[model samples]
Target: MPEIKTLAGNLTFTECPRWRGGRWWFSDFYTHAIYSMKFDGSDLQKEVDVPSKPSGLGWLPDGRLIFVSMKDRKVMVRATDGTVSVHADVSAYVAGNPNDMVVGSDGVAYLGNFGFDLEGGEPFSTTNLLRIAPDGTVTVAAEGLHFPNGSVITPDGTLLVDETLGNRVSAFDITPTGLGPRRDWAVFGQPPKTMHDDVFAPDGCGLDAEGALWIADARRGRVCRVKEGGEILETIEPGTGVFACMLGGEDGRDLIMCCAPDFIEHKRIAAKEAELRVVRVTVPHSGLP
Candidate 1:
């Protein structure tokens, strides 16, 4: 593990961190805004305001910013001139909030969502992994996912999704029409039997150059660098609950983590303890975030 350092602090809750065009960009749930800042946390700017709350972030081939409007269950796009519009609506296919997403090289975005009312204490259920084409066509990419959250696309075109409640990372081959059959990329243990079972609840993740994944273990309050077959290469205890992470810097080796005291909606909405932390690692980033 490398030395952990704070890059930014006093946020409400940060998610969907990304490094692009020489700056760090992320969504603050309680603040209802997206922010960008330099590597050292200087030049901080609020990039956009998303009233429905934003969760995932990505870019189109033509440079438009596409993001998940979590509450409305829609994917919204921002143009270079700062025009925002709904790109695709996924409310017809999901029951809970759409969380994280990974846009493929060809401009197709695969999105994940919470299966039930997690904060409301509803019974756990499964949801679909959705595919949104560049033309705004919405379809189901995969199904029966247990709270699909953070996702990444490998150089070889494999989509790896972190199933937070499943206790596993699921993989799928990115095909022309949609995704291939689902398989386990990494399994920390059996699928969680209930909400309180001790498990490795992976949240947001980033892929390293060596094909390993740096996963925010939401339930453990730590980040684990894991290999394909379930081997954890490194464990980073940042002393807070990490919900999302990204690998990006001038050299593409900086691991940026989204940290907070906890993930409860009421607690996070009432406080400003969320932070962004960084740790430099040996491996650079690999593919789509």
Candidate 2:
């Protein structure tokens, strides 16, 4: 219920905001760059450059940073010493570009795909979810998904993924090898028709301590908190395109939203200028990465 404040300016399509090592890291999909900043928007640094576009971010138990390379359809990792390398190649598993990802406690990274083109083109509808192991091996975890975007693993090792095109969120039991059969976790009834970019539809998300899902509703310009039974608990409206968000601030109660300019009339245009913003809320839950 608070107005969102701009944290940084001049971002070219920011997505996948994650909090790690006392810093907030994110990617500019258009610029193909990864950046990090302090909670107060200080000491901004360019972490690395990626091939094509980069989205979703995760960290290994060994302190390595992992992110999805969209156009390349691969998972890349950056070491603490600033070395970058390909962690997994999943071109054969994903139908389109890899979009967002979440690292599990078992050290495996669960990734989802954009499932289609965004520039007013047709989607590959064959989009699927993949799991990348610590040894750089890739395997299909789920298939026939309608553009799997933001995803997170529960504290008990349950994998929950947001199906943007299908307007629902699904859950799967996590195993050492891969994911189990999925069940319905939540669904967004009657998503706004103004939504176009399937990749940014129900974009980024976070998990609360009680296992509730907080989704950044890009097209609706709001953040919705949903229960495990697909019930809407609350909705926080942050004007503009709420591309992504993360829970970070002094008390770990603030929600930082990565928002783009309104595009109601120009949904097909690929203009940037999305501002990185933050808003404080009464909820005091620290988020899971």
Candidate 3:
């Protein structure tokens, strides 16, 4: 394990860390801005602002950037010239705010939603994973997911979605018919038996060279490396809130983590306390997530 180091700080809840274009890109929920900087943390640049706050980040095969506008439930696109526009309005399919998304090699995106007002302390419910094709058509890719949070697409064309409230990572085969029926790829903790919930939780994750998952469990104040069958291989202490993560760096061994004290909506929307930390591991990353 490599020593964990702080790469950036003074953010109000950073999520959706990504390694792209030779830099680290992430979003600050409270600051309403997306930022990018060198791996050493220099040349920090504000890439964009999302009045509704941003969550997930990805890019199309054409090199256009896509980001989630959490509050407005919209998927936004940023062009090469820095022009931001609405790619699609998802309010009809996902009543709750959308979260993470994994853009496939073909440019199709599979995204998840909260399914409830998490910050307002509302009751939980099962949600759908919205599938948006390159042409901008939106449809339900999969459903009955309990707070589908982070997700990954393996080289073999399989989709693995982390059910944060369900205590398990579910798998689906992407086929012409659509995403196959859900199956368990890994299981951990004793998740609530019901479908409506949040915080039963494994918030964000990354896939390794050997098919293992590096997960950040916000509720548990820790991060864990586990095999597909749910065997815990390693763990990282959470000095603060570890809400999201990404695997990046030259060797793809850098474990980029999104940390904050907590994710209380009201609190995060008002202060600056989030950070980005990096921990290097033996295995490098292996897929689109």
Best by lDDT: 1
The Cα RMSD in angstroms, rounded to one decimal, for candidate 3 relative to the true structure is 1.8
What lDDT does the true structure give each of the candidates? 0.92, 0.76, 0.85
| lDDT by residue for model 2 (1-289), tens | 6676788877677888887777888988767799999888889998989867888888887878888888877788887788888888888886567888988766788888766665457644546788888888887888877678888777777888887776778899988678899888886564423234343356688877666777887677888777877788888876677867767666767778878765332431356577788887666554357
Off by over 4 Å in 1: none
Q: For candidate 3, what is the lDDT?
A: 0.85
Candidate 3 least-lDDT 10 residues: 191-200
- Candidate achieving higher lDDT, 1 or 3: 1
- Candidate 1 on 1-289: residue-level lDDT in tens? 5799999998999999998999999999999999999988888899989999988999999989999988888999998999999999999989899999988778899999998888788998888999999988999999999899999999999999999988899999998998899999999888776766537889999999999999999988899999998999999999989999999999999999999999988999998999999999999998987
Model 1 alpha-carbon miss at residue 139, Å: 0.2
Task: State how far residue 4 of model 3 sits from its true place (Å).
Answer: 1.3
Question: Once model 2 is optimally superposed onto the true structure by TM-score, how far is the C-alpha of residue 222 displaced, in angstroms?
Answer: 1.2
Error of 3 at 136 (Å): 1.2
